[model samples]
Target: MDTASPAKWVPHPEGPEIAFFDTETTVPSRKGESYSLLEFGAILVCPKRLVEVFSYSTLIKPADLNAISVTSVRCNGISRESVGSAPTFADVADTVYAILHGRVWAGHNIVRFDCPRIKEAYAEIGRPAPEPKGLIDTLPLLTQRFGRRAGNMKMASLATYFGLGRQSHRSLDDVRMNLEVVKYCATVLFLEASLPDVLSAATPIDELPITRTDTDITTSSNETSVLVAHIEEMKLDSSNAGTAPSYTTVPIIEGSSGFSGYLEPEEVMTQHITVSTLPFGQFAKMAVYHKDVPLHLCCANLNVCFGVSTKFLDNAGRPKLNIVVEIPENLCKVLDKCDEVAHKMSQEAGSISQWRPLVKKDGYVNLPTVRLHIPTVANGDHAIYSTEMYQKESSGNIQKLVFTKVDASELDTLFIPGNMLDAFFDLDVYDYQQNAGIRLVAKRLVLHSK
Candidate 1:
């Protein structure tokens, strides 16, 4: 509650440091409810050593005590009674500003959540918010770097993955946990990076047989499919409907072979559907199969029930774009079987994440629908649409649209709800954090002429 800055303490004179911070806020229980800062905590650390040099935490009373609902207290255990006597944000504004201003900032989900909370706290006080020298939001950073072994990649989940004990959800306790989580992740990555080199030196690469089935990522007309193309292999193409074309890249085609055999939904047999694991543990892939063959199915002419959405985000802060479509009974049975098999496989693989079914029937008057993911590929430091995009004219010729840059909002204008289109997609199964389900990844989208 003290606004006074303690005497200076600098522990890393030879290296740069980052301020790892966290905030506890009022969770809006009602519509139009604004978040009020409940607590603030921060720790300064040397980036090179990942050692903390200073720490600060304090509770602040919000102007409106009524904002603290039972739901908010249950979320973080911070009640109005506890903060009633605590200093208001205005009291500790000086200390908070000094601790955060002009330094590199880092924390779990700081970019999307905490940073905005900080800005709002300052804005409410009619004061300019402190600016960081640089930013490092670990939510996106770890997602891109560490992979999703720790489940949804939240602070609590990461802590549980490392057996670091339960997260208290209090500001200072959470901030400290955030630092430890990053430290553990860095250690794991370091060890993993070194292993390949050590093993290579000890054993010649040529001597070891590569028994792992290589998932061919190329969806181009060359071969059809791979074992199950790694999501990042950015290319596109699809062969004519028959001939068992799979998702391929570079003119990324819809082939019966994209990855693990992209078959038509019409060709799938529910009784033959099953799930199998790829090589590697938590970071590995899963395959849905029809009898002995991998079941990566494609269907054409699905009606666009809903257009592009950006509600969920990816590692780089862009929307994890997808469109909703009305599906036929055949595709529904196929997807349901795939979902059933995949859910069981994830359970056998020891995942407790909530299962997300690709098919939806409840919200739309019991009409079945499936989502089609529109993915992106890295192009130097940026990403371009990975789904080969095209527009079919009313006259009947289909033409491709080339883009220099792209985003979810811009793509929104293209896939209008109720529009009819032919879609080619990969039925991808995934278990991340605590969410497991099959993803209908679109490889090629041919828009119908208006």
Candidate 2:
């Protein structure tokens, strides 16, 4: 049973305009190790028609004819004497390219191993490699379709399972068997689920050739409509704030000091404070006392205010605070545990908040967080570039924030602000103690006015 012979080739008409190909090489490694193409076979099928079947098998002449012994023993059983009189790779380049042109290449495990090796062979022969654009991997398709019910479906196993004849390792037989699988996949899975649509969606747009002018015109129109809608929505949802808050100030000095008889009196006071936590059923409030005289009170709903704050100081040194109030401690824990999640959430919130008005319907907003790698500088603070947000459909899951890279500049710029302690005063005590303080540390301080 010589499986390599072309006379045994059989093709089906119901398959796609697909080329089922298989290559037998001297060695397995695609790069580093040299491998001669021992045999190549292809079965071309159009919808309901078997167009062509081709096979090219010849011994490769090695420079050191003695080295052919290794390949002859391992791959196709042929000796050095047999290949000494055969044609070189240069002789078959045109025929191979002619057969492969403008065809959707189909092969099992072609993505991981076979396709790369074939391309490498072409490069070695001083010819351009086959375009990967038209390639279709059958392995992923099979996995997606039959992964759940049919565990570990190998090419041989799939062929056997589908009652498509045996898949021999020889090039010609493998192509025939692959054609059968392609037929089965098309009839059983593809047509039912719209394979063409799936393929189009999976393929990147730049790879497809624009053959007709109408396609370009239609694509341009669709892009313009999307841009217009986005602009209109952004206009509707513009935010009031120009920039995010970094710090906020509170007015502690009431009046300027008076000078009498070359003596000036400055108001300076220090107070000891005890913090007490109170938990309401649906909320938490923090109270700061100077011997039971309430100095500051903070309240928040756990669902809304997540115990995070951003404060900005005005020119007068007075602080205006933007607090992420009513936030639960558990959710804060999740954010702290995952820094990437925190960064992503911050980016999304900052970017999407600008267009909040456009997202009128509940859960209509889709905010996608972008992750970037920032390089670290030696001494200076790490610089953070742009933060853009994409609104997407809500996933019904907590959005994750990720910080991909910490550059030297970001490390240098990182500093603990002086007012960070005062910002803690703004957090609901009960929520901080129960939800935040358990996982995070907070220190208190008193500032004297001059």
Q: Which candidate leads the pack in lDDT?
A: 1
lDDT of 2: 0.38
Whole-model Cα lDDT of every candidate shown, in order: 0.67, 0.38
Residue lDDT tens for model 1, 271-369: 888787787664688888788876666665665666677679788876788898877778888888888888888888888899987889985625688
TM-score, candidate 2, is 0.36
The C-alpha TM-scores of every prediction are 0.46, 0.36
After superposing candidate 1 on the true structure, give the runs of residues whose Cα lies further than 4 Å from its correct spot.
1-16, 197-450
Tens-place lDDT per residue, model 2, 255-312, is: 3221112110011112343444456677543443344553332111111111112234
Which regions in candidate 2 have their CA more than 4 angstroms from the true location?
Answer: 1-17, 28-32, 47-85, 148-151, 190-450
Error of 2 at 402 (Å): 15
